[model samples]
Target: MTDCDFLLVGHGIAGATLADVLRARGHRVLVYDPGQANSASNVAAGLMNPVAGKRFALSWRAEELLPAAAAYYRALEQRYSQSFFTETPIFKIFGSPEEQNAVLARSADRPWGDFVASLTTTDPNLPGVHAPFGGAWLQHGGHVAVRELLAALAAEGHRAGWLRRESFDWTQVQFDSEGATYAGQVRSRHVICCEGAAAVRNPYFGWLPLTPNQGEVLDVECADLSPAQVLNRGAYVVPVGGGRFRVGATYRWPPFAPGITAVGREELAARLTVITDLPFAVVGQRAGVRPAVRDRRPLIGPHPTVPNLSFCGGYGSKGVMLAPRLATLLADWLVGEAEIWPEASVQRYNALQPAGVG
Candidate 1:
């Protein structure tokens, strides 16, 4: 039998980063990921947008999250000797004149100014796109090769003898006063479930309102698009490399179903012309489930009743920008050095609906 300090039951951004942080702090960690087909991290476009949504408001804790994410991914890239993060600009097309004025007004402020590189009116003459309504080039935004980063971390964990490429059977979990045992072979002082969109079925944390949001993306090839540019008009067209771009994504809520759909493709295809006039050949299509919560905040902290059991999920599309910082916070809390954010803490839900989780 082997004993460790933590057993993480997922390898998405949250689990992988948390494991790395814990291991860096000299804690024994065992990460389990079966690589589900519906993994959002695997199929996500991994956009690190500091200013998101219709109001163009700064993301929650954007100042801290954005730079922290950039620095963290950079460190991961250097450690793995791979390229995964790109600090590119987001040329966000405005919808109307009112929208443009609002953006410009915010750009004059201190914090918003830091992210607003330049503002465009009636269109910024960028290639391959028809932005008649103009756009703003948002700085400190970038794309993260999420699948690549997850794969890299998995390989490193395998090399370090802390990650398992297999499924964790909850039936085998036996909790004691101190920790829990897996299949009577491995013992961990704590078990944290970072099961992304599949968390709706997580028995311990199922009570939380983890709405599974489905998003589908398309990979297209074009001859004239620049890989250095990212065009954002709600749904974005991100250049991957070598005349290839990723056009996404369709946010389907509730009655969620897995896999790509023809309707989603048609929707993106129709909107593609609005974003750009360049002809493109659809190279590939992918769909994944984002673990979106009811309140749109991440689910973090321990179960209300289960000892040494915790849940970390519900990051939705913001996982790329948010996971590293949240993971660090959870790590600090785990070792008694800090408290979890009240908004993101699972305790909020437990307080309201203690009997909600099955």
Candidate 2:
């Protein structure tokens, strides 16, 4: 059997980032990804959100996560000589007077004061848009074209002789206290499972409370909208280059259904109508299942009993914002230099883990 430092499953943002993090530190990494159609990272717009929801509350630890994530993507962009991440400000239109008031109050406080600006009127230069209740200018965050980024990283990994373009069968994996061996073809010093929404089927981590959710987004050509600005009114419209914009993301939580539907398309169109009245051509629609968790936090770190096996997923809608930072922490933890953040550690559910079967 061939030996390697890590054998990663799933090449979504979680796996791809974790693979790169570990590889950068001098580990021999082999990633398994057949590029599943329903992979969330593939279908995500990869928005880097600093402020979340209607309350205008600071995204969980935005102070630490946002800047570092931008830097990480920038560093990779430089190394690969490819562009994917873009720093585009989101113009959040207020749907009600209450929503406008929340932004006004939050933008006056410390930190929150620094993240957004309450806008009383739409900029005259930005046309094809109208906000009746005013809006908020989110001063931080951007978007990552996830599919391109993953392909670029995978190309580098393949060139370096580390990536595998095949599915990993659980039946062929043997895990012991020491580590894991796959099909007796590669003996891994550590195995990390980054399976996005598919983590519900992970026999090794079934107890982690992984909940899958489906979301759909539409690609439309809007020539009149500002290409540099992302506009949101509950739903978002982000420019994805070539004069085309991506509008989307309707959340279908738990009871997890699969695939795209006409209903989803109609719902997005209605939401987009509320966000903007611009004339546009519908170009495409895509759907994927988000690897959401019941607690709505990430799951990282090694198996409680197995020791060498680990997990890094369940970032859900926040995958782009959280992946890099969490991947760095997991990399350090792998080398015995640090511990996973307690809030994000798989250990959080240790009390619920059934013993002797990790």
Candidate 3:
């Protein structure tokens, strides 16, 4: 009885962008992922930053979620031929002089001043790595090699049979009034729990207010740097293309533990030894968790008490630029067309709970 209309429970990146937006609206999802060994969009380095730094600001909805998440990952790399988004460009290295006068006072107050640029002291392309008080490019920041786009969208949803590698048995999930089913073999009318951070063990969305965080990364190789951008200073090297380099990220919170820790590899090798003494070659080390939400936004809707059980997740560090416009607004609010992001509704935490609490 493997019927389906939706069952997606975490294939990461918000259940592979809501199963490629409900299979491009033809609708008939099934996905049940147990992949990425406990996903955080698979130890993400899938950065899509649009201006973010200690106080450089401007990332929250960076201009309508960065060109609708780069035209939805270039239309899923032209309908699964596969490339996994690239666009790269993000230098941002300025150790001081108050971050080089905070990028000329944030480009004379344009806020993100058109993705900022022009501010250099010169490194003539990688001379011994560490730049002196100069760096600011950002131009359409990019990156998304999330494990080769979640292994090519879980091998094109298991060659279109719609995927189901295992582990999603909430007691074989069953709900009446003809809607949810699962182990009874997928009779789903709705049930989207893009369980990143395991939606805190979702019992109809474990009481909402999640704040998980746990990150940790490092995969150095750094073949003497080049114009391969994405290298913000205090942790964030990202280059990953042969000469390798996907350094860092360390953000623990609440007793989290996705593994890797020796105090997070000595706090990302002491922030990559303050920019670079050179000689790199770590190889690998990873960790997950990040389904953050402490007003960092992103929780999506439907399930104050389960109306077909919906929920995207708290996209902590901008899950690859807010999971394709909140998975096309949670597949247009599950087909009824629109309306949801009222600050990522979950009825805004049911209007701050209380009144007969639940």
User: How displaced is residue 129 in candidate 1, in Å?
Assistant: 1.3
Candidate 3 or 2, higher TM-score:
2
Ranking of all predicted structures according to lDDT, beginning with the best and ending with the worst: 1, 2, 3
lDDT of 1: 0.87
Q: Clash pairs of candidate 2?
A: none
lDDT of 2 by residue, 22-133 (tens): 8889998899988775578989999997887777778888888998899999998899788978987788877787777767866878788677754674443467777877
- Better structure of 2 and 3 per lDDT: 2
List model 3 lDDT by residue over 1-358, tens digit each.
Answer: 8888778887888788878888888988888877766467778899888877777788876878899998989888888788888888888787877777767777656647777756675553564568776777778778898877878888888888788787787767877655888766568888888887777766666667787888889888867776378878778888878888888798889876548877888789778878888777787888888888878888887776545777787888788888888888878877788999688887888765444422
- State residue 121's C-alpha deviation in candidate 3, in Å: 9.7
Off by over 4 Å in 3: 3-6, 9-12, 17-29, 32-45, 48-51, 54-91, 101-132, 135-144, 164-186, 193-229, 232-296, 300-302, 305-308, 313-317, 320-358
Best by TM-score: 1
lDDT of each: 0.87, 0.84, 0.79
| Local lDDT at 243 for model 2 | 80
Instruction: Give the better candidate number (1 or 2) by TM-score.
Output: 1
* TM-scores for all predictions: 0.96, 0.95, 0.35
Error of 2 at 123 (Å): 7.2
Q: Candidate 1's residue-wise lDDT over 105-221, tens digit each?
A: 787787888888988787666777888878788999899999999988888888888988898888789888899999989999999999887777876776788888899999999
